[model samples]
Target chain A: MIERDVIVKGDAGVHARPAMMLVKEAMKYPCQVMLIKDDVEADCKSIMSVLGLAIVSGSRLIIRADGEGDAQAVNSIVSMIEHNFKPHEESAEKN
Target chain B: MANNRVQLKDFLGDTGIIDLQIRLVAGSTGITREIHVGDINRPGLTLAGFYDFFAYDRIQIFGLGETAYLHQLSEPEKKEVLEKFFSYDVLCCIFTHNEEPDSLFMEYADAKGVPIFITKKDTTKFTSSLVYLLNEAFAPSVTLHGTFVDVYGIGVLLMGKSGVGKSECALELVERGHRFIADDVVILKRIDESILMGSGAPMLKHHMEIRGLGIINVKDIFGIRSVRDRKRVELVVILEEWEQGKEYDRLGLEDQTHAILDIDVPSIMVPVRPGRNIPIIVETAALNQRLKKQGIFTARELDRNIRESLKRENKEE
Candidate 1:
């Protein structure tokens, strides 16, 4: 299992669109991922649970992942939040 | 999480479903005000000039007692009390017993953009109904990838991987005189600590996707008898692809449960193969679960009988 904390940088926080992006990003990896805010953990792959967290700007979130590629899953999710939920250049170019 | 708040307009719009029987009397523009709590307050003390521990965030209900108290106050006193009452941001105010608020209260409500509503129902009845409505709206809910069905009056939630035949099994169950609640995306709401209500997404209700047959409406094809809007999830059946050498349960001796939203529901694992009649198996599971609910454990009873007979034979020997 791997755990990392990342603060939301977007002014609007993690709203519906960002929540969807986070779920999409989490679906890329095979590991089970969870987003924890204020001790309440939500399944990262489930959009409803992620949205229910209601993460706000400047809120510290703990990204916990378990199973294969756990570290990569945590790293990618942290980077996604750090970048304000923008698509990565490499992936943007591929698209 | 902030989006968990239900707007005042939402409750008004859902009057048909919940039978609230409420109508806007003042502050129509404030209909969009959000309701943060599922509870309500009488505000009788607030009207009596007692503001300590005032629950202003909750929906305020003015029963006959409060309304009569307001009616007895002089004009100046009423204005003074109303000003102080509206000073704090009250989500909304409701008048039960079909009582109408005076012009001063309506003016204050309009000025503050606090929606005011009146219902013909009495205080206790209306309060209970509104609380029930708000509780349901604010309940913790999660969307799961599964199919929900009612088999022999038991709610059986079918879950597994994407291609694990959960939908097909539910479809067969529906054909066999059962009721289908949801398909693919099941929205589960924790009604209380122990009860979980399962329903389908608004747009995808009663619709199922078979491997090759495409999307079909279960309600339309199977008729109304085979469809239900929601049901209490009493059992969960997980269907998985049959592995080459996996050992399946031969006797139902041990009880199993699957947790959803922190509530543990009785669950069973069924391995699916081409020849297995999954629908009949699910039906039998539902019946067996009903039996368990009635405290009739068939397997345990048989084991107990065998032990008793063995004891008698050893004593005779």
Candidate 2:
């Protein structure tokens, strides 16, 4: 398994929108993905489980992925988090 | 560090006791007197009374009833109690109760350099929990000759002399879908009365240095699920080099156990030889241990089968 420490940078943190985006990205791979904070472990694909963590901005978390496609899954999730989950920041601002 | 000694002045007010000597106050004016409360002759005395009799290193005050009752004693009675409290070899006092102690008691405690703490739990609940915690915290532990490995779906601790293939066996176990808990130096912590947990040191976490392969990161190479932070040690597998003259237990008849922190854990000794499948044997050993825990003993069953066969031969004769 590959594990990396990630800090939430999105303005809304891991709220409903970001959580849904994360879950959708997690579902693309066939590996077991988990986000851990302190002693609590949450499945990355479960929206309820991720939301229950109340992961706010500046909170640090450990992202772990196991099985096939683990590397791709870790890289994709980290990229999404780093990019602030903003696919069309320019277009949204104009609207 | 010597100054760290909790003085009564910290707990009680500065002028709670005039002379500051440990002496019981008796009579109307609180005449100071020295009394031994631990003695049977002086029964019904408070915790302070018992401390006077026995020079205990520490005093654990289990607050059963009202804490205010302690202050209800007359001035002389209170002085007598304080004298016992100061004279005893008490290091610290723990009070268990949701209620607060009397202000005068606090003053005396601070003046006498006694350390006092209050917990929200009741006396009975506090005593039970404290005893449990202390037993585990103070249990004896020792470093053993072993390499703990995460076998296929099991935690197998490999033990043997230096160069007895312990590390080699662990390397193979990791390649076979099992994770690695700790290699070489495994630090064990006593979690509870009956449990001992094992974890790798910070420098060695997720990094295993094999003799032939050098250093390798298990997490980076295998992935996250292939490594664990800690694991509850379940079985101890000792690997001994094969000796021609030595007798080996081929039938697992005798029961073996390894004692760790006063708890007996199931143990197995496997003979190592050229071309032998050590990893597979170790995996079987783990599975066998799990089955044994479920009350199914394979060794005992084999022994029973042999006995039945012997009985049949005798009847035929």
Q: Which candidate is the best by TM-score?
A: 1
lDDT value, residue A10 of candidate 2: 52
Which candidate achieves the best DockQ against the true structure? 1
**Compared to the true structure, candidate 1 yields what TM-score?**
0.78
Q: Each candidate's lDDT (Cα)?
A: 0.87, 0.65
* Model 2: CA > 4 A from native: A1-95, B1-44, B48-52, B66-68, B74-80, B87-89, B108-113, B150-155, B171-181, B187-207, B212-234, B243-247, B257-265, B273-275, B306-317
How do the residues B1-317 of candidate 1 rate in per-residue lDDT, one tens digit apiece?
21375788888745545878899989888888787778889999999999999999999999999999999999999999999999999889999999999999999999998999999999999888888777778888877778899999999999997668887898889888999998866888887899988887675667777767756889899999999998999999999999988988888899899999999999999999899999999999999999999999999999999999999999999
Span of ten consecutive residues with least summed lDDT in model 2 chain A: A45-54
Task: In candidate 1, list every pair of residues with a backbone clash.
Answer: A54-B1
What's model 2's overall lDDT?
0.65
lDDT of 2 at A31: 93
Model 1, global lDDT: 0.87
* C-alpha DockQ of every model: 0.08, 0.01
Give the top-scoring candidate (lDDT).
1
Give the lDDT of residue B233 in candidate 1: 96
